[model samples]
Target: MNIQNIEPKYEILLDTICKTYETGKIKAFNAVNTELVQTYWEIGKYIVEFEQNGAKKAEYGKALLEQLSRDLSIKYGKGFSRSNLFQIRAFYTKFPKIQTVSGKLSWSHIVELIKVSDDTEREFYEKQAVIENWSVRELKRQKDSGLFLRLGVGKDKKEVLTLAKSGQIIDKPKDILKNPYIFEFLKIPEPYHIAETQLESLLCDNLQSFLLELGRGFTFVGRQYKITLNNIHYKVDLVFYHRILRCFVLIDLKINEVRHQDIGQMNMYLGYFANEENIEGDNPPIGIILSKEKDELLVEYATYGMNSQLFVQQYQFYLPNKDELREEIESVLRGDNEIII
Candidate 1:
């Protein structure tokens, strides 16, 4: 046997062995995660049942959790703190139906969720986490950043409750809009000046994080997409297609404050897409103008008469403070009430 030929065979054998071992490890990790989640769910059910049938006492609940934690930790060896047991109890109280929790979310995700007091907010986070396949950290970030409160603003109480309980319904255009979109992934400095080119490039580079920021159903298409109308060439900053809406999404980038002209330009781009690029049976294309600043009045005036679907939204390079964002959202809802009054 030639030494050179033997080297190739040895490398190939090593590679196969390594890959097979890695695959087995991955499967084992997944199985462990699934089992952990199931155990937590069962623990939650037991806690709820104990409160209902056995204890029926507040102090007893605490004592029972401590005792249970000690016993479970001795047998299971880890992940059975008294606080965690309480969290499991709260989890059952919040989501009595196990069927509602998608298998995509693990026990760690539910532990973070159990902290939310509002049932609607809890459900919204749960559904969004499941649908988005959000990591445990992402779930915590969204909750801490007040994503549910921000998205729930401007909606009626019933609508808010429905969205919180069942997640956003994609039946209407407004359903896609997320007020104060979470941008924790960006990690940009606060009050920093960013160019449109820079923003577009960053988003394109971190397309997965950008899609999560853009809410759901968005699949990246391309950047600087060229189109022609009457021999006049125009370029859209970014283009995406939404699977749920079944339409092309034309995104225009704006660095400075958004003006009526920006919205108008986006409308024109959307109109061109609807008439030219959109295929038969495809929904009319939607245009989104992403700017550092957007005036609500300007957006309303620009989109008032246009048959084309257009939206002007402000983009932040960094995540907003949770307390401030929550308050802002609440204030917006109050302003809506005043307008109604």
Candidate 2:
């Protein structure tokens, strides 16, 4: 035991043992987590059942939870606070059929989903969470950014329903689009007027968060992806490959309102990528012009005759107005406006 010199195979043996130990720990933790979630669901179910059988349902509402919280805390120790119990109860109420609940999501993720009052919106996030394995924090950010609305607004009603039921499916170029892409994670400074190059650099610095905001199936190709046509050179601000769509996505950043010339520039980039960059099995490239401001009329005309698949969207430095967006979505659902994309 005291020998200073170790055998050649000793390190390998120790490494294998360490890996096995870590793997076992992870498996055990997951098993415990699953059981814990199931137990919470049962508790919620029992609470609801008890209230139904009570003489006065109102008596079993607040008072029942308060007494249960005190008793559970005293007997089982922490994690049974009134707020936590409320969440547990709501979890059951929201998802009565335990079979429908996702086994992939953690309790924290479920808590965040429970806060989403809209049934369709909550279902979208739940399915997306299970499919994408989004962390609790990521789920919160997406909800705050009004991802459901972004995907559903101005989109076909049936497609929106499918998206809600099955998370996001990238069947076509527009499936990956998010209007007014949120970049609050970049944390731009006081003046809030960052140059295009500066914005690109900040995006790189926060690449992970940026990719999450970008949605599913995007892999970074390169920054300042260059293309040369007839001795003149141009750079796309960001280049990403969509694994699902099997296409190249080129994005350009603009600090000012997007001009018609900017739209033409992105079309050129897409043309270059489609003809010159695409491989034998690759699909046509898609271009996105992300600007600080855009005129719907201007963009409509700028992209009117373009052959290459191009999109003009806004990029805000901060989170969007969630309440306003939510109201818009509610209005749409109520048949106030039937806008199509």
Candidate 3:
């Protein structure tokens, strides 16, 4: 009887209807995407089988893709270009088993994946893309950033292969750590100097890229997190909670090379966190001292036999040559030393 009250009810009903319709449309789109990928794979298989057959083997030469594209486009209208057919063929070659294909990932995502030549590396990227819910652009960013190569640098050949086959496994504080963390996304130029505060500010400004560089399961907590002990105050540069590790990560930034005092300071931070911040269910907090450079011998001697979970690693403002970094990592592995955490 009351028009105004009834109008509110109608609005609610309309909202629900629109949401349900949108949800259904999304479901339909996902189903169609999955089916389209499956269709492409089947078509690729057919083409491969035709070429393998004695009669059609020679016919499927240089002009095979062009002929197929023309005929398919003539029948089906569009989306069957030579490039697409080539991609479809490559897709099949990359993932021959349909069971391996993820329905959640669209053909656009797989198009980027097919470019990866190594089976383990491809598997790693796919797993990470799904786990991290990376968009097509994000996936491309990871690829261009040489994420797999970055992870493999410090590991032995076997460990590197395992990393590719299986995404990062975070059993310990050391597992998630990377040396010389890349921050080229900040758009900072090479041979430039920036203060620690400015560096922290830039990282916070580009938090998404920073998190991607940090890897999976990390959620931001705060910056300049302050703690007081014995009437003295200290502030941490950045703080993050690692969901998988079940611990708080405290990072301190330095523009210069890491010194023993830096490690000692991180040790103190870890102590404060483990004592004051960690609850009953939480693990001991980990501390990272991020500097532009670290003296390896000093790091080894300083960190050795330290009870606290403190790690010192270098950070780069620009992207280093992947091949050079790869070689550096392999060279370090030859020494059979624990990787710089």
Compare the candidates by TM-score and give the number of the best one: 2
- Summarize candidate 3's per-residue lDDT along 1-341 as a digit string, tens digits: 86667576887787899999999999999989999999989988887766666355544544788998999999998999999998988888888898888788999999999998767679889888887788999899888777877777767767876776667777899888876688889999867679999999999999999998998889999999999999999999999999999999999999998889888888988988999899988999988888898899999999889954788888887766877765654554455555656
Per-candidate alpha-carbon RMSD to the true structure: 4.7, 2.5, 3.8
Backbone clash pairs for candidate 1 read none
Name the regions of candidate 2 deviating beyond 4 angstroms.
1-12, 55-59, 189-191, 338-341
Ranking of candidates on TM-score, top first: 2, 3, 1
Highest-scoring model, lDDT: 2
Worst 10 residues of 2 by lDDT: 1-10
- Give the Cα error of residue 300 in candidate 2, in Å: 1.6
Once superposed on the true structure, which residue ranges of model 3 sit more than 4 Å away at CA? 1-4, 7-12, 54-60, 324-341
Encode model 2's per-residue lDDT on 58-119: one tens digit a residue: 65688999999999999989999999999999999999988888778788988999999989
Comparison by TM-score, 1 against 2, better one: 2
Q: Which TM-score value belongs to model 1?
A: 0.79
Candidate 1 lDDT, 225-323, residue by residue in tens: 998888999889999998899998888888888888777778888888888888977898888787777788877887898854788876666666667
What TM-score, to 2 decimals, does candidate 3 have?
Answer: 0.89
